[model samples]
Target: MKRIVPLFFWLFAGSVAAQSPNKSSWAPSDNSTIVRIHRVEQVKLEMPFPDGSSFKNLKLDEVMAAYHIPGLSIAIISNYKIIFSKGYGVVTPGSSRPVTPTTLFQAASVSKPITAMASMALVDKHVLMLDEDVNHFLTTWKVPSNTFTEQHPVTLRELISHRAGVNVHGFAGYNRNQSLPTLIQILDGVKPANNPPIRVTAVPGEQESYSGGGIVIEQLLLTDVTHKPFSAIMDDLVLHKLGMINSTFTQPLASQWRSKAASGTNSNGKAVPNQWFVYPEQGPAGLWTTATDLARFAIGLARACNGTPRAILSQPLAKAMVTPFNDGGAQCFHLDPINKGLFSHNGQNEGFESLLVMNWKTGNGLVLLANSDNGEYLWDILLQGVSKEFGWNYHFDQKPKEWLLMAQIVGVDAMLKYFNTQKATGLSENEAGEGDLNQMGYFYLSDGEVSKALSIFKDMVQLYPTSANAYDSLGEAYMAAGEMGAAKESYSKSLALNPQNDNAREKILQLERK
Candidate 1:
């Protein structure tokens, strides 16, 4: 129950350049626009309170420093053209090598959409069928069939849209020294493969459940059908066609490219061990790309959506890529209901994070890549700034959870008073949500504010008495405060509510031993 809080929440809560042959001629008249964007004030949280108070605006550098992000690269698309692309900070912390537009970063789950795009390209040809059972094409490894797959066979369409009902949400790539698993070993979840067996867990096509495991199956299917490496297939179908010269699906990234790749950094801004993890699961997470290269991919999709002839993907296929299979997801992207024509995806690896948002119809998009785990904290703020500057319709209306912010800016007593006041008024409070409050408690606990964390956890138990997670979190706070008896009692209550609370059971054992 003691979750790893995003650095932003702890602080507030207490919390590109590579061009394609189809490139547009549009160019900004001056550097003024980019400068203004960098200086754009931090987003103001629209408090529901009567006073309407907001936080002071901070510059981009200030925010980056606060979040401990080592490096960031960005590319922006407008009017179906890349109008701006640049990089800020260093490729590694304390290093003289500055991030450049061409510097590569791990694309993480953002690789999924590109992989999905490649699959669709196969569909466009006669090579693959979206509706056919994937097992038919999978010669090397087929999805292990079970009750969940008996009546509902998995299809490429379902896999691309995350409706395939497979297990294993994602993968943790191997360290440099770890022995790499063969694709077959990975599929069987055998030794050297860290994840469990990728198998059907629910009725396929019944609903959307993200399955990176399903994507690996797709990777194998492509390889089995084409009799080629997964990385080469992607290049042939998508990357080469789109002219994304700096992108690759290669794992243990080619030695020639390593010098241009940004070193991944932890939340504290320290370099990841051996600089980065090597992901062999190219379909789900393996990608080394620059912001400009990714922007080219986005622009290609946009052009295809506009029915441009000879685009990387056919018009029909491109439209299908953006069209949601369900309310939540399209082939590999999530459609934002509030932002019309917007399809987006975000990615996270061990010490890297990324985001890609595009309005396919208008050819407007943003790509953000960073080398630090704390990178996501800057996304919304930067998105808001970009949207404002570009006059785009994108809007992020959710007010950030500001309990930690209030505690930092004002005193804890005042923050608590405001919380109680808002609760008494019967108004929906942003800070009162179960997840938000739990995150706030974990933030405090991480900051070594044991008393503050205890108070927050106690309130969570009061607010949601029957919630097992709430009790589990309370138990963690009690244990952190060295109150063994109270910790055991809270753990007991948590277990009584939900016998499946493994963390609580583990804590109970640890406390008994003590």
Candidate 2:
């Protein structure tokens, strides 16, 4: 069974690391056109998440079971209310704590929006000027030196928006228990500083730089401006006002909170719990929350967006805060189109993944947090349930089964087990005899499973005796497999199915020459 599926090869490839060899046939769904028309219509409703229904098909319990997530939390915000917030599974899998709505999970990057809210509040109070150089209030940290470009002092807006133009990038180092360095030391590549972290290395305001250190620099300004630690500021400003009693800025496991720490599995597939409080990088990353509390935050933003009553960040600034910026990554969660936009953010540590989605219009939003690395699978499923229920545009194509089947084939070593066990490579002479086998053949073909593509095409020809496209794709698959003779015959058969087949005719001539 020479399966010819080229696996995705990338080092620390960002989420959606889809470079798989068997992942060539994704004709982005008809959803793209629908998305444009909706944008044109700009449907205004009290709530649009699941349209006429609630996103409740795959319950939290089911998703947790599938992903091995000890705990999971989700909140959907619309109409300025706690419209949907729930928790499922276990806090520790073996422990007795059934995850509750208030269970505190390590709110990874979700912390940034909290920080953004705090900063925007400061902006409203005139204590934090968005356009002013952050250096004015900051005395403890200074930008690192680099010859790549001149350092134009970064502003408060640039830091929060991830537009500082220098990505200090990932921090596989710096965890709990070790004496953490000052934010300045982290940026300067000083002692105990595990990774060099990304040096300012680029001119400020030139591009987006996703630096946790940049957020730390912003945190330091909290002290410089307010004469208090970030923890206190969060307690006084965000927690108290929002009434997020179960959530805090400290480590998830240590707080007097519940045992629902967000978690993820390591390379060995062992579940690892996550909550880092070694250093408080408020602007970039550092904050813990529960789905319930997070839903409140999302609700507040949505209310503020729709001119509904709320107090998170005032309508305009909260509107501005959701605006997108470069994060040393691709364009995603874009809230403000070419003009004003909103953004999406994710948090990931050893055992957990967290996502927060905010929309600039109608102020609708949603967040899903998981206690396992595969928690994203739950997110995908929930998004589907939401889309099917509400008809709202969350932008996830409903082809998850197809995508996951492909992902499983590409991501796992079980390919030979499943692919090699199939029956005859072509149709069984009976009409209803081989339905499941044919579906599997089609699955393999759509996913770039080269040998399977060939087999499926052969089956289609035998079963239908009149599928031009099927035969054409079969020819292309053989051509890809370096079998010119087989490809030529397949192409010729496809052209015979329809005399107007220019593409198949051309391919047939090309194969003949070959």
What is candidate 1's lDDT per residue for 1-514, written digit by digit as tens? 8555321121121111111111212345778774555454344533343356544554455456555577788888888888887777778777768787888999999999899888988898879999999988988777888898998999999998889998888999999889999888888899899999888889999988888899999899889989999999999998998889999999989999998999988755568899999999999999999888899999999889988878888898888888876455566687877778888888889888888888987788888888887677667666766777888866665534555445544545566667767777774645356676676677567657889888888877887899899999999998889899999999999999999988889989999999
Off by over 4 Å in 1: 2-27, 39-54, 326-329, 400-432, 443-467, 477-483, 496-500
lDDT string, candidate 2, 253-304, tens digits: 3545434454444322344433333333444545667776876777666566
* Each candidate: RMSD: 5.2, 14.5
Poorest lDDT segment (10 consecutive residues) of candidate 2: 6-15
Task: Estimate every model's Cα lDDT from 0 to 1.
Answer: 0.78, 0.55
Clashes of each: 9, 17
* Alpha carbon lDDT at 386, candidate 1: 78
The prediction achieving the highest lDDT against the true structure is 1
Q: Identify the runs in model 2 with alpha carbons over 4 angstroms from their true place.
A: 1-63, 145-151, 173-177, 251-255, 258-264, 267-269, 273-283, 307-310, 324-343, 393-398, 401-514
